[model samples]
Target: MSTPTVVLVHGAFADASSFRALIPELLADGIPVVAPAVPNRSLNGDAAYIASVVRQIEGDVVLVGHSYGGAVITVAGVEDNVRALVYLAGYALQEGESLGELQGGFPDSALATALVQTTYPLPDGSTGTDVSVDPTKVHDVFAQDVDPEITKVLAVSQRPLAAAAFGEPASAAAWKTKPSWGVVSSSDNTINPDVERHGYQRAGAKIVEIDSSHLVMLSHPKESADVVREAIRATDR
Candidate 1:
């Protein structure tokens, strides 16, 4: 096997730019990286979009997902060419499990109080819910380790996720069949750290813990990149 290309998937409240810092680091290590902008409107739709992106890549892929993106890749990473899956403070959900269900057992996330919900028209002409973290709480709950200045900008530009995305049950669990790795953000307030550990442990992933917030890729890009590289090496063998 040869070095696999990396396809990064960002979770709710974020876009492809969320992986900006980690991309260059992966590229520096000679790994090709692609961070596709996830629509985040629906779980199956997002996974299908990512699967299409994976199909366009030239070789095997190491699919990496953050936050809700973990659920996206858990569905998309089952693509034939995907050799590994890496979850960064991400949800590694089981088949038929929804993010909402998995989160039910965890301690209340700070994001609950910080979220702002708005109604929007869906393609079907029905009203849908879109959720985003309150700007004032973005830095504290989502990216505490990052500099407040940058987080301030992130808060304003943050993408909103459709509330339905969380309730959508995952149709696949890629970790069940693929090699897996995980980065547990020890200080994560958005997703309880214990929840992350349980997800990884259940998947039997090689786990690495970092003393960072939910935005580990931003707060600790080097470490995040290193973990991706480790997955590449493990799969390339």
Candidate 2:
């Protein structure tokens, strides 16, 4: 089989640019990659968008998702052409599982305390809550290992996730059928590392532990990219 185009999905409080450093490494090896901006609105809603992206691709696809992006691919990867999944400190929620349910089972991380919610206008004339890491706490709780200069920018510029997404159950769990790989950021102060471990273990994903913060791609791009490449190689049949 031909080398599959790698589709990257970023999680909450992040956008496609989060993969900035990693993309070059993959492209350097002649790898075709696409990192799409997710809406950070709702789980199923985001999944549908990503699924459409995958269906339009020319060849096979390896879906790589980080953080909440993991949950997005968990549903989007149900597309026929997605052959593998690479999870980067991502939520590998099961079908019928919600992020709140999975994370609530484990002890709270610094992120729980660091998050701040604000209201946004809704189409129906009601207000909805958007969740984001407190700008002052983002660097410490979300990406301590990342460069302060970068984290400072990320703190204020981070995308806010719709709070509703935390309760929405995933409609599909792609890792159940697709070959999957995972990276656990042992130093993560956002989602508890144990949550990452349990999610991957339940999905039967090949797993590795990286001693980095939630933003593993920034602090350990080579290692994170290595795991992604492994999934690509294993599924390129």
Candidate 3:
């Protein structure tokens, strides 16, 4: 049998490039990986766009989502090829759920306040949201475990998601049917560990916890990858 294909969907404020480093390692292990860059962070558009990519890859598939992308995959995982779903410190929005409402249960964190963006006039003089982070503080908040060079690159490469995606709701949650896997970052300050546990429990997914930050894949790639492989193996049994 051919190796199973993996589709990686990145979260808000990030594009497909977020998986650039992780993909190479997985590919080296003979896993076929595809990371589709979603346009402007619209989950609705993202799900539709990623589903298109999912249709093109052959064999059974494992859909992986990080942060907000988890919610995207949950909505998109209903596609025929998706055999398993993996959530990496990611959101798992349930049926008819929206991030706005879901976030209510979780206490606000420093990451929330740090996201305040300034609107500026674009080339056409139309005002648009231009998001930025306190570069000095990004390492501690986003990619502390990643190589300093990589963390700097990611800080500069991060994109500003349109405000609309946060309010977008999931119509159908695929995790209800597909077997799931979840990774919880115990030290995550952006996404509360308590909230992550709630999501993992709700999905009834096989769970793994790590004493890492929000970016667990970058912080603990080998372990994160191994957990993902286990999810793929679970589908075999």
Candidate 4:
């Protein structure tokens, strides 16, 4: 079989740039990688956008998501040419599950205290709430392992997710049908590590654990890339 293209979807409070470190590693190994910018809006919209990107690819696709991006791919991975799913410290929610619902059962995330919410006017003339992690708390809550300078920049440039996004339940769970792999950030504070393990376990994904923060791809890019490489290799068989 031909090799699959790796489509990366980043989670909340982050943009495609989060995959910068991991991209080159994948490229060095001759793997094609594309990190789509998730809208951080509603799950359905984000999933649809990701699915659209997957459709644009000419060959098979291995869809990978981190954090909330996991939820996006879970709904998007059902695309015909998507051959696999990879979650990096991401949510692999089941049908009818929402990120908020899943996190409710787990220990409270440090992110809860670190978040700041603001109201913004939507194009539809409705008001929407946007959530951003406090820049002062970014290092402790999201990127403890990343360089202090980079974390500062990440804080300022971080994307804010729509407050409604967390409440939106996943309409479909592609993980149930697709082969999946997961990377658990052992020291993740933003999302409980146990919750991550449970999601991966339920999805029956091949799993790897890395000692890093929620931004595992940034802090431990090589290890993160290794898991993505493994997923691509598995699908090639």
Best by lDDT: 2
lDDT tens digits, residue span 20-94, model 4:
999999899888888878888899999999999999999899998999999999999999999999999999999
lDDT of 2 by residue, 1-237 (tens): 478899999999989889999999999988899999899999999999999999999989999999999999999999999999999999999999999999999999999888899999999999999999899998899889888999989988889999999999999999989999999999999989999999999999999999999999988999999998899878767
TM-score of candidate 3 on Cα atoms, chains taken together? 0.91
lDDT of 4 at 129: 97
Tell me the deviation in Å of residue 151 in model 2: 0.7
What does candidate 3's lDDT look like per residue over 137-169, in tens digits? 567777777788877877777767666677878
True-vs-predicted CA distance for residue 176, candidate 4, Å: 1.1
Question: Which residue pairs in candidate 2 have backbone atoms (N, alpha carbon, C) closer than 3 angstroms, thus clashing?
Answer: none
What's the lDDT for candidate 4?
0.92
Candidate 2, which ten residues in sequence have the lowest lDDT sum?
228-237
Error of 4 at 236 (Å): 1.0
**Which stretches of model 3 miss by more than 4 angstroms?**
118-132
Top of the candidates by TM-score: 2
Stretches off by above 4 angstroms in model 2 are: none
Model 1 clashing residue pairs (backbone): none
C-alpha lDDT of residue 67 in model 4:
95
TM per model? 0.98, 0.99, 0.91, 0.98
Model 2 TM-score is 0.99
Q: In model 3, what lDDT does residue 2 have?
A: 47
Clash counts for all predictions: 0, 0, 0, 0
The true-versus-predicted C-alpha distance at residue 86 of model 4, in Å, is: 0.5
